[model samples]
Target: MPDQTTNAEKLDRDAVADRLTDLTEELRAGENVTVSVGNKDMVLTPPETVGYKIDVIKKQSRFRGNHETVRIEIDWKPR
Candidate 1:
C-alpha cells in the first residue's frame, strides 16, 4: 500500500511558522490594527497603527477520532 498522509498532517510546523511570519509582516507594515483570540480582543494602541488585523481561532478538542482544525478571520479598516 502507498502512503496516504498529506503534507499538512505530516508537517504541521510550517503552518505555525507561516502564521507567525505573516503576523510579523502585518505588524511591521502597520497593516493590522486589532487582534482577537476567543473572547479576548486587543486593539493596537497609538504609535501602533494597524490598518488590518488577522485573527486565528482554534477550537478545543473533543471526543476521539476528532481532527484538529483552525479558523482564520481578518479584520481591517480604512486609515
Candidate 2:
C-alpha cells in the first residue's frame, strides 16, 4: 500500500509565505525536509531535480460568488 499524508487549512498570506520560505530554505540546504501534516511529521528527501507543476482554476457561482485557486505541486522519487 502507498502511504500518504495530506493537510489543508486556511492561512493568511504571510503565514503561507512563511511556510513556503521554510520549505524553500530546506530544499536549498540539500538535506531532508521535515514537514508537519496534520498531526504527523514527514521527512522528505527530494533529489537534485524534481518535477514541478502549477495549475490555476477560476470558478463562478451565483450563490458562492467567484474565486480563483492556484495549485503548485513538486514531487520526486526517493533514493
Candidate 3:
C-alpha cells in the first residue's frame, strides 16, 4: 500500500493563508517542504516540475444548507 499522511482541522482564513505562505516560501527556495501535523512531520522534496491539481465542489440541500469545498493536490516522484 502507498504511504499516506493526513491532517484535518478548522482554522481561520488568516491561519490558512499563513500555512500556504509557508509552503510557498519553501517551494520557491527549492528546499524540502516540511509538513507538520500535531507532533508528526514529513519532509518532501519536489522536483523542478510536479503534478498540480485542484477540485472545487459545491453542495446544496434544503435541510443541510449549502457548502463548498476546494481541494488542492501536488505530487512528484522521488529523486
Candidate 4:
C-alpha cells in the first residue's frame, strides 16, 4: 500500500500554501500582517504612501513515486 503518512504531509503542505496565498493578498491590500510557517514568522508592511512595488515568488516540489514528481511556482509583482 502507498504510504499514508506521505498523503497527510501533502495535505498539510497544501494548507500552508493556502494560508500563504491569503497573507500575500492581504499584504497587497495595504494591511500590515505577520505570517508564521514552521518556526518562522515574517512581518510585512506595505510601502509608505502609494505607487510602491512588491515582488513575491513561491516554489514547491513533491515526489509522487519512484520516478514521478511535481512542482508549483508562482511569481507576483504587486503594485
Candidate 5:
C-alpha cells in the first residue's frame, strides 16, 4: 500500500512568504519537513537525490475574476 497525505490552507501574502522562507531553510539544511493539520501530522524526509516538477494553472470566471495556482512536485525512489 502507498501512504498519502495532504495539507491545505488559505493565507495572505506575508504569511505565504514566511511559509516559503521556512521551507527554503529546511531544504537548505537537508532536514525533514513536518506537515501538521489540526491534530494530525507527518514528517517527510527526502532522499539524497530527487526529481522535481512544477505545474501552474490559471483560471478566470465571471464571478470569481482571476486566480492562479502553482504546484511543485518532488519524486524519489526509496533507498
Candidate 6:
C-alpha cells in the first residue's frame, strides 16, 4: 500500500502538550489510537512489537532566529 500523510500543527504550548500527552498514554496503554484532523479521522493499532524513530532538526535564519522540529514515527506489521 502507498503511504498517506496528514499534518496537524499547533503553536500554543498547552495545545502541543495536550496532544503529546494523549499520544503517550495511548502508546503506553497499548490501545488503538484514534486521531482526527478537521473532518478526517484515523484509527490505528500498532503490533505487539514495532520500530520507532525520532528525528529532530534545528535551523537558524537571520530573520527568524533559531527553531527546531521533532518528528516521531512508528512502524509494525502483523505476522
Candidate 3 Cα lDDT to native: 0.88
Per-residue accuracy of model 4 over 31-69 as CA lDDT, tens digit each = 665655456665555554434345455545576433443
Candidate order (TM-score): 3, 2, 6, 5, 4, 1
Alpha-carbon TM-score of each model against the true structure: 0.33, 0.89, 0.90, 0.33, 0.68, 0.72
Where does model 3 exceed 4 Å of error? Answer: none
Model 2 misplacement above 4 A: none
Spell out the clash pairs found in candidate 1: 31-51, 31-52, 32-50, 32-52, 33-50
Top-scoring candidate (lDDT) = 2
Query: So what's the TM-score on candidate 3?
Result: 0.90
Model 1 misplaced stretches (Cα beyond 4 Å)? 1-12, 31-64
> Total clashing residue pairs per candidate?
5, 0, 0, 0, 0, 0
Residue clash pairs of candidate 6: none
Candidates' RMSD to native: 13.4, 1.2, 1.2, 12.0, 2.3, 2.4
lDDT at 6, model 3? 80
Determine which window of 10 residues in candidate 1 has minimal summed lDDT: 2-11
Write down the lDDT of every candidate, Cα atoms only: 0.50, 0.90, 0.88, 0.53, 0.75, 0.78
Question: If ranked by lDDT, best first, what sequence of candidates would result?
Answer: 2, 3, 6, 5, 4, 1
Local error of candidate 4 at residue 70 (angstroms) = 8.7
Local lDDT at 63 for model 2: 100
The collision pairs in model 2 are none
